[model samples]
Target chain A: MPDPVGAVARLQQELTRLPGVGPKSAERIAHFLLSGDRKTAVALADALRDVVARVRPCRECFNLTEGELCPICSDSRRDAGSICVVETPRDIALFERAGSFRGLYHVLGGRLAPLDGVGPDQLTLAALAQRVRRGGVREVILATSPTLEGDGTALYASNLLDGTGVTITKLARGLPSGSSLELANPQMLVDAMDGRRTL
Target chain B: MPDPVGAVARLQQELTRLPGVGPKSAERIAHFLLSGDRKTAVALADALRDVVARVRPCRECFNLTEGELCPICSDSRRDAGSICVVETPRDIALFERAGSFRGLYHVLGGRLAPLDGVGPDQLTLAALAQRVRRGGVREVILATSPTLEGDGTALYASNLLDGTGVTITKLARGLPSGSSLELANPQMLVDAMDGRRTL
Candidate 1:
């Protein structure tokens, strides 16, 4: 028999639109929400609505935040003279979890992908340049991923800040920790050899 | 830096409670919602709330439905005399998808799993017995899965409907279609041999 109530189907349909969720996963999630406590589903719904209404990009750095400025931008203790540039706000969370980087961050919104029609205009490159040109900043670290597009984005950003006098740098690349040398790809091996430093 | 917006954290926390969603997956989903269109998030919330407020078990067969009776139970075209018994409302959907068995269904809520503290009382077995004893039902097909708990639940249900003058049957046990003979376990091979029929 057809599902008499359309709500379950609607919920499943909406769930499939998420990043990696598919039809099977959507069905499982829908069933879980329906079978469990009503509050769980309602709470999730409320949270989604609440976040969508309140969350927006930080005015200064474009990182996601509810207030006018992101937590890093508002914090008095973090080094305002140094900035770390990333492709998205999610990357900032990774750096934060590591508890390293004591500087500010600039979310580029996205990387430079010409094939996908993304260009410098699509990212926050102009804002990053303006912040650096305004002065006081001593360094601008390019922390984008080491993929082809990521490298292109970092190169493009570096050129954009050419005359700003900010010391530009990109993240170091090599074999990841806990990985065996036997499993390292040729490019990783090349990077490890090229980037080897004194112990 | 700490997330200034608590909504994102709350959403990720609640999403982790889902069956297969973990912290990483939840974070991805939360970010997706926060960055995407506001309507998508609101639509999901509405669907979830609508489902929780409306859907309930069919009073007769215990299958999930918005009305007093499920679609199969209310339809006159369905064979009421032949009731197919299953473990959950989801099983009814599987049978419906196959487009076979023009009969009503009885959802037992759950199967007998003594180790997990589930018993006949925890299921809808009492209601099932009541339905069989009410007369007019000619056959009760136990269509539970071929697992240990499923088989045990079927056996217990069969015994409960004894002396009701209704014919008791069960779904066939064998290797599934499109499966290799080499991959079939010893028990499945034995079952296939014992239940063989001449073409």
Candidate 2:
């Protein structure tokens, strides 16, 4: 009742602000931290402070980094002429985990959501444009999600790069690799049919 | 790859130590923190520090509190003569949420898990005995879970208070309210049958 301790309640309140953490989860986490030794709590606090203090957007691609450029931007092995554009840095991690993409990435910060007042100016679109115009970028792959907002963002981005003479493409849509045709939604089935290729 | 920032990686690693947070979720949370403004991260860090520095076990019942006594212990309207024994302070919150138990609480810290090297000395059982011996407590309700370890803990606690002239009772076991018979496990069915009451 009323939280046995004020500090614990405050910690729970702060924890709820994190993405996907609800009030119940926050309370559980706060109590978990208190139940164990103080080491875990202190370490987490220090880590949070350190991340906030050190991490900043990469100079070239807007990915999170502690220095002037992100790891991909600083690396010479990655293909500089091919850029995989994504909605957020989190998407970059997903692509990295897949380990198929050998090119650098451009984090758009977020896709366009005009109804929520988000527009081209709000994202790092201009920065991306500058990166493309400055040099020898051969291809720009729009790897946004299959949602309507993602499609709209990709369309807007492709239009933005129309006169630049660089090849612009978006990720293909279809039934997911492991999914059954019977379980595929109507839109997915339509996409699979439309994008069918010869073996 | 290898985390864009060392601080972010460390934050992710620290976050994984939190209950139910795996590597993937930790990465997501770490990146989410980085994506947002510094305010959220900073506030969480401060709250963690405050909780660690201020909160302590309640002197009376071992429940978490900032002061010498927990809120329930300090509350004059509660029935101090009747103590509900639970395994953790989190359980106290659960009982409080139910809003039925008006008695004080005694946190046993954890149940009897001898194989895990947790013995009677590891818990606050001695303190609980001291509380019972020092006072006019009329009843000690064993509200530990209805599991093997929980039953062992309750039995041990009951034995400890055998000569104290206090009524020692335990929570009843039965099929949970609203649960269907088909869904009930064999053990639950047995408990329900054995614990049948006269209407």
Candidate 3:
């Protein structure tokens, strides 16, 4: 049959490309957008564009930001002597929401997933090593997810910083296995932060 | 504490505004976008913008289209003598997907819901009535959803077309209650079409 509603069909297809959105959900969203006020549709489009245009990885920490450095990196009040490593910027946001971490963050962009072709070179591992070697950094916290890939990435980073004299710590096991920091409850996250163990 | 990853947090907030996207799903989508390729993000943004810029309701059928008239209204092969009335463009798509309806369509934009302040004025009933009176319309099918609002809208439209001399019919009752034509299985929809009843 002729796809007369081709524009709508295309919209649904594009929406389903996003994670967790299936064909049914995409269709529902397309209908909702078409039925809503024109301004709402326009605003969502603009937000999508703005996010891509204004946001970039922080040069130092890889967290998303509008400027050369992420806000956390530029903030003078944050502890300059400590860095918490994470897999993505969303993890940084989760930690920030709990209001417990006052140190700097280093986003690895992704964990070490050799199966997915992600290696130490693909991540910001060199920048992290350089930061550790530059001195005054008392600790490097491995706050990556507890997944196998996260554990592997942590081990790789720890090995690289073995003789650098900087203390290496990993977040505690209070967080359940296979759980993302992004999905962890605030209390559990706080417990994990408080009970961090030295590597 | 300060939201260090404010950009991601804001992006998630914006995503949750879309229909059927709850907070958890929204977060998942945001993380996906953050981790996804720039081209995918750009494509989604472009699609949203394109839909907003190009799609508008057809003047005659009220079906969404990129021009003054929808493809169904403009197509010469369609049976102009028969008009299938539906509550939304999504419903029109469902009917079209069946590939059996050679008739043109009229989208009511929504069903009658007094509690939601939706009335006959909010619908395309007047336009449909005008179309029915203008000429060669042998039949006007009330294919609105089977819900209370849908039945109310169908009844209201039937009353308006009372003296128009065109035959009035409704899709059969094989469709389950409190469900949408968009969600009906193809066989059930075909059965409803094959077993239509005249009023």
Candidate 4:
């Protein structure tokens, strides 16, 4: 209606695309940025740009990284033979925060939802299989969410890594029902990941 | 300490600066941005830059604007004789959403917080007085928040407009006590501003 009062409308439109920001939250943030020093907005913009430009998918695992490989993937001390497969990069962060996983990670980008048109080809299933097939992978833990889609993806991953002598596992049901790895509490995730069950 | 992962750490550091984003929230947002298409990040940064570059305070009322004057101040339909004073531009947004108070707004930038060393001179008090003194102003509505700082600022504004013949008013305490104007619901704010009492 009246061109929506300044850059606030534009800023709100931009901010609402973020993961959790709602219209009201976007409005509040836009107003906060507009009323304060220009530097804060500039800093936010620069950070977004920098992260987009510098952060690339880790080569070995699909976790986000500034380098060719993610920290967990590159660290020799970590057990590379135990790759924890997760649906998204944030899941890796959760596991890392849980501090129970000293293994590398394989980010699937998303779970396999056949009803939604996402299949094995859509995720990092190929890379995960190749990583396992290349030998030395003793265990492959599916840390995907506890949802139906997560279960389907885990089953697919299990099949893909079959006969490789790699023990296939899934995070224990200690995580509350109907929760993603990202939402699981650190202690619960630690318990689940540490006491994972063979699939 | 091994340099802390990758660009995620850097991005999280930047995101935590937003009003309500905590460290955990920042991490989630950072990973979300990095994993998405580049255009999303670019769009967010561009919007921030565009807002920073274009948005300026209305010269007449100090409300945010992409041009010389904000839309409310620029509109010919709004009442010009009545000026509503507020602590921030968001307050103006809240009032506008209430669909009431079709008048100009004077953003005080902040209230007088003596303990924090903020005095009358720190806000837009002098500019407000000048705007009112320039004449044709029938009423000056002091819509500053309901906190101590807000009360102090309102008291100070009332004294400054003394004998100026302009009826000074304060928003009726329809809002919850000890809360800022920004937190007030639209209906409550409308009732408060509509039932404002002359001080």
Candidate 5:
């Protein structure tokens, strides 16, 4: 590619490091930065610097935060006696967006992937167990995604919490609310069949 | 949504401002940056800042360069007498990659679009005309894209240079080497027919 303006090219390169961006997209973005108003570029640059400098993981839930505790963990109105476990903070956001859950959360950092050398020890499993042992927790919801790794992580967590007096529950499965058979995937079919309710 | 690390969230927001990036992709990138080594982020940021600080448009060709003239404009081997006019600097790079042309270039910056209020005066058409009028030039190639606006710009340019004695030519067209005829658009069909040569 023809070398663009130094700053434009530099910004484009940084932007291209993002997933799904190619050289053409990078060039388009660079051109936009060069031709766009000064305020936009400055805002973008400042945002980049600020994100790197200010954001941190919450001490209690591992959710993103600007302070020691995330907003969810600090909220007194949430159900502290029931914790929902997830593999990432994004998952917590998904749940929050659904607006159905009012419980506390625990981010596991990642799921167990033996091929990648990730195990229970590498995750927040021990912390979760400690939290469970400290007691009064009525239920532990396994809300990990339905992927293979997610399922494995949920099963492992369930095993870890066994005999701890806290009831374990997984999210419901069936035909998705508005979908027909024609639109469902193979896994969705199996899950729907496996989770069928009796009259 | 739960706020991620402040730095990470800020970076994600900045990244999403680029064309084609959405929130999910931005989040993926932010996570990648956080998971990556510090050097990578620093290098990316430095590159962005440096590019902005140093790069500028070449005075004569409008191609990107660290100095007033791009490498193509300064190269002794390039044909100073011929200029290839393109809609963008990215086109200059594409032509250079083809490596068949030995002429220098002039970027019009963009094609004319009345709806968007872009017109002849907004482009580098006058500069191109001036270059053609300066005497030794023998040919000017109209390599604008095959779009309605691109054609309009080309015709406008041809009319502007009507008395200049310079030979104007457009790039050739046919079924692109690896592309299928079924996939060819109407404009491509028109160009292919118009550009046909005796077998």
Candidate 6:
């Protein structure tokens, strides 16, 4: 419902479109923006605009980056031969927080989910094959979620890189079998990344 | 700590300033913004900036407004002789959503809280008294929260309007004694407004 005021209602509507924000939370957030620090609200708005306008997917790995490549891909010290593949840029942040995976990362943009019309062409499989074909990659670790879609994507990616000398691996079932990688705690992520096995 | 990338971390930091967003939720929101619907995030950012820039305090009643006065203050159909006093703009929205009130409102900006260093000087009490002294207002309803700060503000406002020939009323403690007017459900708010008692 539109709030008593048009702006409040509009704001509540905008917030409800977020990933996890519901109607009640949207109301609270809208009221807070209207009532709390104007500077804070302005800052958040500016940040929101800036992040979307400025941050782009890295050219090589497709992770969020202000430059041509993401920070991890640009860092010279990270193990260049080992590419830890994840489903999204946020997964990279999760890994970084866990203090695990010193190697580089490749973001698939998303996994295979035909129900949602997400297929092989919808992902970054071609880019993965190209990167592996370029050589020097000793191991390709699949850190996608352990869900059905994630497994299908991993199997598909493995078939694409089958001829390449790279040893393909998947994160151990250390994560709860079907839980999301994004929801894993830092310790759990650390353990999962450490115990990855050849696929 | 700032994330490895400047824009990602900046967005996360900005989100953390919101009322209920913690560090983890900030991270989640920031990442979701980057990866979710680009149009939705853009709209929210625009709304945030628009809300702060456009919604100003109503000139006569000190409630939030997109123009010179709030809807209630501008409407000719409302009961001009009854001004429901409130602690914030959100309370006015809450009451309006209840659809039980057809009177005007006077926002106090905030309730009196001495420990929080908020006093009469910090509120809109002077403007309220001036409004009452200008005459024609038959009932001045106090719809502040039911907390100590709310009661204290109600008492102070009552003292200010003691001899104005206006009947001042407080929303009966129809809400849970410790609940806030802004957080009250529409049904509860309707009941409270209906069961107001003479102060």
- Candidate 1 on A1-199: residue-level lDDT in tens? 4653577788889999887899878877887787635788988888887888888999999888889998889999999998999988888888998888999999998899999999999999999999999998999999998999999999999999998888999999999999899999999999999999999
The list of candidate 2 runs beyond 4 A from truth reads: B2-4
* Candidate 4: docking tier: medium
Q: What TM-score does each of the candidates earn?
A: 0.89, 0.97, 0.83, 0.87, 0.86, 0.85
Q: For residues B30-66, could you state the per-residue lDDT of candidate 5 as single tens digits?
A: 6666543444566566666666667677899887788
Q: Candidate 3 overall Cα lDDT vs. reference?
A: 0.84
User: What digit string (tens of lDDT, one per residue) describes model 3 on residues B82-198?
Assistant: 999999888887787778889999899899998999888888888888899898999999998877788888999999999989999998767877899899998778777877789
lDDT for position B182 in model 2:
91
Query: Per-residue lDDT of A1-199 in model 3, one digit per residue for the tens?
Result: 2565666778888898988789878877887888857676676777677777777888888888878988899999999999999988778878987789999999998889888998899999999999889887999999988777888999999999999999999987678778798989887787789878899
**iRMSD per prediction, in order:** 1.8, 1.3, 2.4, 2.3, 3.0, 2.3
Candidate 6 residue lDDT tens string, B25-86: 88878887888568877988888888988888899998877889877788899899999999
lDDT of model 5 at position B109: 86
TM-score: the better of candidates 1 and 2: 2
Give the runs in model 1 whose Cα sits over 4 Å from its true position: A1-4, A114-117, A181-190, A193-199, B1-5, B114-117, B193-199
Residues forming the 10-long window of minimal summed lDDT in candidate 1 chain A: A1-10
lDDT of 2 by residue, A1-199 (tens): 6555789988998998887788888888998999868899999999999988888998899888889989989999999999999999889888998899999999999999999998999888888888899989999999988899999999999888878889998898898998798999999999999999999
CAPRI class of candidate 1 = medium
In model 3, what lDDT does residue A36 have? 54
Which parts of model 4 are misplaced by more than 4 Å?
Answer: A1-3, A175-199, B1-6, B175-199
User: If ranked by DockQ, best first, what sequence of candidates would result?
Assistant: 2, 1, 4, 6, 3, 5
RMSD of each: 2.7, 1.3, 6.3, 5.9, 3.1, 6.2
At residue A52, give the lDDT of candidate 2.
89
- Report fnat for all candidates as fractions from 0 to 1: 0.60, 0.79, 0.55, 0.68, 0.46, 0.65
The DockQ scores of all candidates, in the order shown, are 0.58, 0.78, 0.44, 0.55, 0.41, 0.51
Best by TM-score: 2
lDDT of every model, 2 decimals: 0.87, 0.91, 0.84, 0.83, 0.80, 0.85
In order of listing, the candidates' clash counts read 0, 0, 0, 0, 10, 0
Better of 2 and 5 by lDDT: 2
Computed on C-alpha atoms, the DockQ of candidate 3 is 0.44
Model 1, position B174: C-alpha lDDT score: 83
| lDDT tens digits by residue: candidate 6, A37-123 | 688788888888888889898999998889998878888999999999999888888888878678999999999999999998988
Chain B TM, cand. 5: 0.92
